[model samples]
Target: MKVNIPWVVGLTIAALGAAGLGGQTARVPGSDADPASCAAGSGRITIATGNSTGVYYVMGGALARLVNGHTDVRAGAAETGASVQNIRQLVAGDYDVAFSLADAADAAVRGTSPFGEPQKIRTLGRIYPNYTQIVVRADSGIRTVADFKGKTISTGSPLSGTEAIATKLIDAAGLDELDVNRQRLDLTKTVDGMKDGSIDGLVWSGGLPTSALTDLYTTLGSEDLRMIDPTPLLPEMKKKSAVYDTATIPKATYDLPADVPTIAVPNVLLVRDDMPANLACALTTLVYDNRQALGAAHPAGKDIRVDEADRTAPIRLHPGSERALAGLTSR
Candidate 1:
């Protein structure tokens, strides 16, 4: 079955752009000069996404299309390893925008997550909520976090936000990160391991109803698979930062027994603090104005709203974003 990305990404609505898609220069309006101004140019803007199976990749691509369609700017989306990689490249000027998780975004701003120093990233807006999903085969006998004492598990890839969430979830579940058999693999390999029983469990954090996850659930069937609810430990998670909260993955999403309580984190659109202001303003304006068109392509894009542009974590809004938020700009 063909899953519609734009319709199912968010509980509220739409998503946007981020990294390694290709080389993205700038498509500035011919009139843009003042870094704080919005004008015109003809070039390219690149957005970094995440693991191909995750919502970030789909939504990021849709956002790039939306920007290219709505604004004078030409844009493209690149598939990336996700938040950590996206943030690092975004600051290095390898990318103009990136899709990042709030936790990593917070960590980057405060110089916490995977980076050793404070990053210069700024926010475009809060796009969507990522649900922490832990899937395990019924035969694994992993009823609780502690039950996975020596079981093989996929903790996600390095330099990806999935690893960050997996580590924290393992901690919150009262398990030792080192005690579990950890395999840091990407989505494709993780699914393969789970199917073959080489991995007893796997952790993935992404927008509701991840495509790879849907495949996992369908292949595993109800008798062989289940989700581990992590909401009871939310208080412990919040201690790490305010970026995490309670989220529910409806039974209808993966055909689970019920809504599984889990940790919720927001997805953010990011740019360098020094990004051209006019471009920022124009980009921000294009998103809010053309959200419907975007939503038609990726459900997560429905969440991109100028009114809520300041919802990003500890990161500050770009000057252009601020102007757009205040209704004084377009992009």
Candidate 2:
């Protein structure tokens, strides 16, 4: 039930530095001054992360610190709705790099629903898998996605990857948009709603041990809350997109009684296709080289492996990232 105070403090300082609100520079751990190895480009860049309490925000903060300390590029992380919004803003030139679910990125590249036309986006690489977590109030009498009818559910922030998945899950369960009372709220608000009994359930796609969910489980206790398994809709979900897979949320993550079965999606680091290759290459290098430091910020960071990094399919790997991977693998 204890919070990670150091990680919180680190994120705060990084946020302040990124916003230019701090007078003194805080030294980032594991930073280096080797410009040649740090890539050959220098500029200020911004990373689009997800809701404040999610893993994207934590990882993005770590990435910003890594970039600022080791590379010539000064970096900052902005909290957004995730995936759908990240890609939109990344292409709009609002962010230099972004975190997104593979499904949304694929939709962006193919110009699928939620996107009117093919987007000119590319990937740095795949980082980690996001587990789809659906939780309901134990007293709500909700047993499955089918029981969602007439129940108020938080489908995640508007235009977020969580919302996209939530929609797919609902449809796969043969429910219409109007069948359930859908509330489009961010993780923070969704947690509040669940606690207040104003919300019966929620659909969230995030890294394991999400701070917001952790707080919820800690405050509400198991007797008041329960996790639901949506793998029953997996075959239907895969028919729509191949990004989903079966995974488990170990009880240790939140001290539940047992592992929770769920669907999983890979998350990718994305950028515009026109980004300078040298800069992209540099950023990719920083991510892998500082994996340990990133993991220190969040356990999800350790899942970012070089071998699995270039697995971003459908969404083409950025040329710069390809070059960085090539160099990394050859060594």
Q: Which candidate is the best by lDDT?
A: 2
* Model 2 misplaced regions, further than 4 Å: 1-40
Pairing residues by index, what is the TM-score of model 2?
A: 0.89
Q: Model 1, 1-331: lDDT tens per residue?
A: 2223232222110122232323444244323555655553445567888888888878777776666555555566777788899899888876778888889999999998578999998987777678888889999998766676899988887878989988887787788887899899999899999999899998899877788988988898867997988777788889987889887888998899888888888888898887777777777776676678766766656656655567775888888888877873333
By summed lDDT, the worst window of 10 consecutive residues in model 1 runs over 7-16
**Candidate 1: segments with Cα more than 4 A from true spot:** 1-37, 303-307, 328-331
For model 2, residues 1-331, the per-residue Cα lDDT tens digits are 2223222212333465657746865433213333334353555667889999999999998888777777555677888889999999889877778999999998999999999999999999999899999999999999899899999999999999999999999999999999999999999999999999999999999999899999999999988998999999999999988888999999999888899899999999999987767777888887887889989999998888899888887999988789899888787
Whole-model alpha-carbon lDDT for candidate 1: 0.77
For model 1, what is the error of residue 74's alpha carbon versus the real structure, in angstroms, after optimal superposition? 2.5
Which residue pairs clash within candidate 2?
none
TM-score of each: 0.86, 0.89
The candidate that achieves the highest TM-score relative to the unseen native structure: 2
